[model samples]
Target: MLASGLQQPAHGMEAEENPYLEIVKRNAFDLTNTPTNTQQKAPEPLKANDIKLTGIYLRNGVERAAIALIEKDKKNTKPTYLQLAVGEKQGTVEI
Candidate 1:
């Protein structure tokens, strides 16, 4: 899956035969150079309104596992920014 994400436009070349070369060619610019514009841009900070609960259904076994992982992270000291809402009904939780 990671390989497919990094795969390059082969332009008809066989990917299986030379996957490494394909990755190198595709990421050459990103690997070798930095952006010419040096002006740094500050990322826009999230506002209070941006934090909200997102609902997702536990459809099957795989989805159940995914939800478990998300829920586990939510228990950490500095939890991830994502808010996971499970089950058939919708609800909200205060931070």
Candidate 2:
């Protein structure tokens, strides 16, 4: 009510226009225009001949068990490790 004792418009809430709706509505897409099956590059394969097991340490009463691996590549050599508790082994590495 505009300073008058008159009944308000239907519950006093009217549908308001959203300004951004026009922009988004114009950019709406359909399945026909949608892209699918994007090209994905395959990862470089790891060769088993290049991986070497350096050492295996079995756990003692208080000591931890660990397996050390060395991967030799043309760029650089890297060391990988797996640590385990007594009677535990990690999933086997193929290489």
Candidate 3:
């Protein structure tokens, strides 16, 4: 004798009923709802070309990464270094 398999339909969660669904709605967009006169332009996002990987090291057991930002200041010749691990973020860039 052969048995037939049945499939179940996937269900969607409504935001009004579930708090988890509402969390996505809040963070999904970067909407700026400001008055017409007081609104200012958002800062430009950091580009990949502006970043340089300086070093990577392991401490204890976890690994860490360092990066330098390439700025256009003639007086400040030294690169500004940022140390980050895992999900850490510097400015608009995340590691």
Most accurate candidate by TM-score: 3
lDDT tens digits, residue span 1-95, model 3: 45456535335744356657666678776556765578778999755446788899987787889898877544357777888888988786588
TM per prediction: 0.17, 0.26, 0.42
Q: Pick the candidate with the highest lDDT.
A: 3
Residues 1-87 of candidate 2: C-alpha lDDT, one tens digit per residue:
375767454332341354555665687664355468778889888664343444455446544545565554533655667665556
Point out the higher-scoring one by lDDT: 2 or 3: 3
Off by over 4 Å in 2: 1-61, 72-75, 93-95
Name the lDDT of candidate 2.
0.54
Provide backbone clash counts, one per model.
0, 0, 0
C-alpha lDDT of all candidate models, in order: 0.46, 0.54, 0.72
lDDT of 2 at 47: 62
lDDT, candidate 1, 1-95, per-residue tens: 57957867665557557657777778856764666788989989643232323444465442321221124334454433443333432233322
How many residue pairs of model 1 clash at the backbone? 0
